[model samples]
Target: MNEIELTIEQSKIYNGVICPYCKGISEMIKSKEIYGKDYGWLYICKPCDAYVGCHKNSKRPLGRLANKNLRKLKNEAHRYFDKIWKLKILDRTKAYNWLSEQLNIPFDYTHIGMFSEKTCRTVVEISKRALNDNRRLDMDFGVEPVTEFFETI
Candidate 1:
């Protein structure tokens, strides 16, 4: 495990955040509450918690997708969203192709004869994660985090 220590000076100096869990630079996150709260804000782990405010770091690397690859995936997702706005079952072909290109994970899309349903579900979840990551990228690029957008969603 990487020894992640909070730089108190840095934390105090800036109004930003450091994760209480791993002490990594915390990224602001939003969560949808079911009861009365409905939605709220929090700081979270950048690498692991794509959007759900999950802090536990996974072995998986963040944005392992190249900037170019991520852009392509994001654009394709927008197109997919245009075709079908439902968040549940996104198109498998687009999702797999983009993920394969982004992660450089060699996969035979056509040869995926057996686990089609499982693959579609997995890709849908990954697509949501990728979309969340895209928002973070927008933030990094100086696009404002629209709190209203989070509240309404």
Candidate 2:
């Protein structure tokens, strides 16, 4: 390829950074799975990346969109709610006392009559599990070899 062509190719591949998890540069892996159907970011390994050739006409990213959004939201919410959640464990009595006073509920500082402790506990446990699972993928490179599962059109 000519120098200009090489530069263009380099620019396209370098447009985005590599996956923090696997240290792979994001690339537009070719697919025959069709346009919208074959959508997604593919992080290629260093050098040629050696992605499987696609006979189909489509491609897709392996990462979950929801997980990305959740991470962003979690980071933002942590700035505000981290204290409350920490207080919840370090000084449950004090946290509940503050809640009781702020809400003007009939419950006293000692009694958590205003909230369903069971329900709250369940929600917190489930949320914690979800967060843990999500964090596991924080450094994950998602799926590799876009051509492996590329649905042939």
- State each candidate's clash count: 0, 11
TM-score of each: 0.27, 0.19
User: Candidate 2 at residue 6, lDDT?
Assistant: 26
Candidate 2 backbone overlaps, count: 11
Candidate 2 per-residue lDDT, tens place, 96-123, comes to: 4544444444333222211233423333
lDDT tens digits, residue span 1-153, model 1? 223343674332122244333445655544433223434554345564422222244322222111223334444444433232233333657655665654444544222211223443444455555656655766888976422122111
What's the true lDDT of residue 2 in model 2? 12
- Poorly placed runs, candidate 1 (over 4 Å): 1-97, 101-115, 144-153
What's model 2's overall lDDT?
Answer: 0.35
